[model samples]
Target chain A: MSTALLHTGTHENQTSLAKKKLLPYWLLAPGIIWLTIFFLVPIYQLISTSTQTQGYGIGTYVQTYRFANFMDAITSSKAQLFRSFEYAFLATCFALIISYPLAYAVAFKSGRWKNTLLVLIVAPFFCSFLLRTVAWEQILGEQGFVIKTLRFLHIMGAQGHLTATPFAVVAGLTYNFLPFMTLPLYASLERIDIRMMEASGDLYANALTTFRRVTVPLSMPGVVAGTLLTFIPAAGDYINAELLGNPGTKMIGNVIEARYLAIVDYPGAAALSLILMVTILILVMAYVKRAGTDELV
Target chain B: MVDASSSAHGDLILKNLTKTFGEFVAVDDLDLVIPEGSFFALLGPSGCGKTTTLRMVAGLEEPTSGTIFIGKSEITYEKPYKRPVNTVFQNYALFPHLSIYENIAFGLRRRGVKDVDDQVQKALDLVELTHLASRKPNQLSGGQQQRIALARAIVNRPALLLLDEPLGALDLKLRRAMQIELKWIQTEVGITFVHVTHDQEEAMTMADTIAVMNEGKIEQMGSPADLYDNPQTSFVANFLGQSNLIKGSIVDSSGESAVVDVFGTKIGLPVLRNHAHDSSVLVGIRPEKIRIAPAGTQMNGNILEGGVISDASYIGVSTQYQVEMPWGQELMVFEQNDDGTPPLSKGDSVVLSWSPIFTFGLAGDQDVNAGSEAHPESE
Candidate 1:
């Protein structure tokens, strides 16, 4: 009788746990289905359209396997490829440097002002990205306050112009991706126990030592997530380079857009898009391996 | 590994220490001198400033005013690391990212100590965690994690070690085991161990001296036996252990004895108070000191006639009885169950008696109310 009772109790506990596990999936099913339809299906269609042959066997693959196209794009447009990566890398580094302290202040120092600071950080999202980027162009234009200030400070020479420079493009990218970096870093830093720092200090580590040993290691998940979010999007961004950069500052995104829309080269555009996607996939996989993906989320 | 500069019998002296969080004073004008090489416990209920005092000493908190000294050195402005102190947090606060070996080596590494591997191995051996040195805190049991926390703190060999309810998270059996283990570890290390706990039994069993705190003040401070036997205040009497506080007026008083009428029964107490003619006082007696006999039995010394109102609970080696006296006073009596079981039953008439020397008198005031109010809430 005791054994039977124990079995029933165990069965009841297992049923409860199973039901709890099912509830989350039940709630998540609709979102997964929506993504599958809108995002996954379209991506699958893009891959199939890039590889499928029309009327002949493997004709599209054969035509596009002009793997030489990838080489040609890189060799002929090496400037644009390097410029895009350089601008994206610089922009990501700038965003990380500025956002880490901002997120730290919001997560640890602001205390009761945390919610208000977070709201302020996210307030830029209320404006359209194009409008915000356009606003920066006006601010850095010849007649703008920055140019006037620099001229007043005797820093701008006769040839000094903020518009149409790689600096402008990188700045624009950093501005566009600042929120992405700040929000994830803010989340991770906020979840860190304040006592951990106190414990470090109590163990004879100064502030800098504690930050290097404890704070940076613990916040790596956020750093990886923020880097991926900013770098991937910035690499493919065309608006900032188009609006704020010179003709010499054209990025890979501009080339892909020109191939698809201006030049009407659908195969080339798809191939370039696939390459960008693969690069991002490789980066994400590496990040997931280093810092557990669960921690990232 | 202890800091040799402050190692001459590292005694801690706090002078007029006070801390306030906004309008609430957590610790008020606290002055305590803890000698070196002694296990001292700060005993109090939650929010009584015992934890705040411990934190101030650990340098986790800054006092609103006053100074602290460790072995003739004024360390009031010193950071926790600069001071010769380490803390074992209540939750054991072991670094989750590091293994036990790395956790123990953290302080030594920060201090740039040589031979870290040998020191880590020694600490692991001291805590009996040599086999589990590679294990993470999450992978270990609660008791094992507690030992690792102790190992982490003592490996640094600071002049003082502070523990804030270190065994509070363990199960009863584990807590009991760790209590003895911690006491033995403190003896083996021979360091100044300032432990904070709300468990009176834990304090009594482990501490060389116990300071009972209440409402941001040290209500009483002495050895566990001193606090238990001759509690100066009613708060000390009730806070340290279970006591029946009988309210009465002193009708007769002499040098070291007083006759008090409690609920129309004249009970002779062995404690004398100045100006006790018409002064109201409280008589405190531990339940174990009171003996229970079957009715119609002759007894000696402050005998009370009562009937057993509750069933006798056989708590391992002792039986506790709740006897209801004629004056509606419910008295608890603990009888040793040496032979086997209790000889009394529920609703059986019984005689409850205690010796005069077993009872002590405390001044009747708000302190008595404070003791009574704080005692039941802790349990």
Candidate 2:
């Protein structure tokens, strides 16, 4: 009778345990179904399309497992691939250099104007991104006030122009993704204890030393986050290159876009996309490992 | 490592040191001289300007009007990094990104001192945290972090070490332990430590001399026992510990002592202890000095008769009693639990008596509860 009683209690606990265990999966059902249909299915289809060879004339392909398609795409568009990374890296660096002081001022010295300054940083976003890029064109373009002023000051010669250059493309990328670089830095910097800075001063560190040793190191998380945010999207972006650059400055994103939409080269486009995704994964892993979150608590 | 400078060190002095934020005076023309190698405490309530004085000394805040000197050099406008001073900030602001070892070595490294491993290791050993040298500050407990902060400041070995409520975050038991540890460390290092705190007990426990402050001014500065036994101001009397202040007026003035009358009873006050300029005075006595007894019991020295017990709390060490006298004032009395007498119930008639030597006189015009509530953490 005692054993039977114990067995019944175990049975009751097992039923409740089963329900409790299944609750998390039930809660996750919507996201899982969404990812499976919208994300995973496309990934599988992209993989399938990447290895196919042309079976007939236009828009027709067969499963030939043509792995060399990736090599062919890379060989043909390697310049664009390298250019994409170079532009993204430069933009990320410039964004970080510009945003650190901006974030610092907002975090520490702005006093009552902190919120206002943050709002101003995000104010450019109220307009559409495309409209903003076009506005940059008008501001930094060949006939813009900036170029005219530079020409008047003799900083630029009579033949100098701002549009259709690598500088303009990188500048556009930096301007467009600036907010992405700023907000995370602001959040991380604002959480730092002011007492820690004063403690650094008390420990015989001058202001510059304190900033380098304490402030910068403490804000590394934000730096990492902001760099990733700026770089990833900037690398895959084609709008800025198409709007601001000449054909020579085209990136891998532009190539992929032309291959898919204008040329209808499905296999080549899919192969290039996969290569870009895999390379970014490898680079990001190495970057995070080198950045070393081990120092953070 | 902190070098104890030899000839240039005399005292940390402030001449008319003042700090004002707009119209509100934080430190009002404060003048002070902290002798070298002494553990001094600036004890007061939160807004009483003790911290403002400490911050000025550390060069964190610019004084509105004043001159500060270490020996002969004026450092009123000196940069914090340039001054030979270090402060253990409140809440143990340990650098979260740095390991325990690095945090302690930060000062030496800033001064371009290479080979800092020995000093850092010594500091780690001093705080008994050498085993956790490689761990980041955020990985430590509050008490451990507090010790690391102390080690960091002490490792710099400045001429003056300012501790701003360094143990405020610790639990009571740990606070007691750290209090003793800090006092020992001060003696061992022989650095002039200026501690700022609102905790009266902590100040009395650790300080060689304590300056009791109120309203941006020093009410009294003396040894702990001197302030307790002969408090010149009502604020000092009440802030330092529990005091029973009985309203009285001088009935006779003599060479050695003065007699003050309380309602109907006469009490003797030592002439040296009298602080009143006129006949009016407030007679102060610590609670534990007065012994409670049943009415009509024969007692000696400054007896107040016709008293009834109003309340009694039988704590483990002592039984605290609230005694109501004939004059309609409640006087507190603390009786040791070892008295071998049964606890007195409320409304029991009793008379309070104590030696006249324990009595002190303060100016009667001052508010009796001036520092009672200002004790901040007084129970």
Candidate 3:
């Protein structure tokens, strides 16, 4: 009778414990389902398509495993891949340099003007990305105000245009991704204890030394996050190149778009998309290993 | 290491330093001379400008006027980093990313000190944190973090070490332990420590000299015993410990003593040389100094008759009684709980008396002992 009572008690306790464990999962069910359907499934399909081919079983995988396509993507089409990387890297660097001071001003220096400055930084996003890019095209075209000013200054000829250049593509990318860099950096810098800097200064460290030793190290997580945000999108972005850039500045995204739409090569597009996602995932994982995400948050 | 040059002559001197934040004056003109190798405490209640005074001395806060000297060098307008002082913040503010070793070594690195390993190790050993040198700040307890902060500051061997409520964050037991440790460290390092705190007991126990501040001014600056036994101001008397302020008028002043009349009670208080005549006075007597007797008993010294309207509450080693006199004045007397025996209970009439020498007469009209405002009788 005691054994039976113990068994029944254990069963009841297990049931209650199970309910406690299941409650959180029940609450999280909708989000998990949405992520699975939208993101995970699409990624899985891309991977599967990359590995399959029409001729031999796993032929595409074998060919891709040789990395000839990657080399071809890099070398062929008039140095398209290399030029794309150069433009994206430059854009990401420029964005970082410009955004840091802006973030610092918004986060620490602006004081009562912080909210207003942040609103201004985010106001560019009020218009859609496509619309903004098109607007940039209009402003940088041959008849645009910038070209007209440059010609008037005698810095450029009358026919000088900012459109269809790598510069225009990078400028567009920087404008589009600036908020991504600034917001995270601002968040990170804002949470830094101001007293720490004061303490450092009191310890005889000059302003420059304090910044290098205390401020920069403390804001590493934000730097990593901003870099990831800007780099990933800039690497894959083809819209800027398509709208304002010439054929030479077309990125991986353009190649993928052409393969899927213009060439009707779904397999090649899927393969390229898979490679890009994997590369980004690897880089992000490496970053997370170096700078823990908890610090950023 | 104690800088022999500074040790020969006291490092810090604040001459009439004042700091005003807009309309609110945080620190009124304050003058203090902190000797080298002394643990000085800026003790006061919150918003009394104790922290502000310390910060000004450290050059963290610029004084509105007056001058500051460190080792005979004027550093009134110098920036904080340029001043020969370092501060251990209340929260420790240990660099979270750095290990204990790195945190201690940070200042050294900034100063470009060579062979920092020895200095870092010595600092860790001084704080008894050698074994935990590799651990991050978050992995350490509050006390450990506090020690790390101390280690970080002393690693630089600064001329003056400013501690801004360093022990305020610790638990009572830990705080007590740290107080001793801090004193020991200060003595061992022989560095002048200017500690800011609102805790009276902490000031009494740790500080060699206590400067009691009130409303941006130093009301009284003296040794702990001097301030406690002979509080010059009412603010000091009430702030340092509980004191019964008996409102009285100076009936007569003779030589260095005065006879003050409190209602119908006449008490003689030793007056200072500067005591004013015909002015209202406050007779400040500590609770412990006041003795209680059963009603109708003839007391040996100056006595006031009252009834024990409230029973004594046994507080570990002492029993506190609330006695109400016939004139409607309430006096609190504390009796030692000897041999765990109980004392008189409620509704018992008692007489309260103290020796004439124990009573301190403060010039009440000066608003020194009155704290915020003048008593109506004195007004």
RMSD per prediction, one decimal? 4.7, 2.5, 4.5
Taking the tens digit of each residue's C-alpha lDDT, what string does model 1 give over B1-379? 3352245346899999999999999999999999989999999888999999988887889899999998888888777777778889888877777778888998899888888899899999988889998877788988898899899889888888999999899988888888898899999989999999888888988999999999899988898888898776777777777777777888877647778888788888875422223468777788999878888789898877756656677787788888887766677788887765446778888888888888887776534445665663456
Which docking band does candidate 2 fall into? medium
Model 2 lDDT on a 0 to 1 scale: 0.91
lDDT of each: 0.83, 0.91, 0.81
What is the per-residue lDDT of model 2 for residues A1-297, given as tens digits with 9 covering 90 to 100?
Answer: 999999999999999999999999999999999999999999999999999988879999999999999999999999999999999999999999899999999999999999999999999989999998888888888779999999999999999988889999999999999999999999889999988889888887888989999998988899999999999999988989988899999999999999999999999999999999998889989999999966775
Q: What share of the true interface contacts does each candidate keep?
A: 0.40, 0.91, 0.64
For model 2 the interface RMSD, in Å, equals 2.1
Model 2 agreement with the true structure over B65-154: per-residue lDDT tens digits: 989998887889988888888899999888888888999998989876766999899888888999999998878999999999999989
* Residue pairs clashing, model 1: none
Better of 1 and 2 by lDDT: 2
Residue B81 shift from truth in candidate 1, angstroms: 1.8
Tens digit of per-residue lDDT, candidate 3, span A81-193: 56666777788899999999889888889989999998998898788999999999999988688998999999998666789987899999988999999988998899999
Candidate 1, after superposition: displacement of residue A295 in Å?
A: 8.6
Lowest-scoring 10 consecutive residues by lDDT in candidate 3 chain B?
B370-379
Predicted complexes: DockQ each: 0.39, 0.68, 0.50
- What is the Cα-based lDDT of residue A88 in candidate 2? 97
- Which consecutive 10 residues in model 1 chain A have the weakest lDDT in total? A52-61
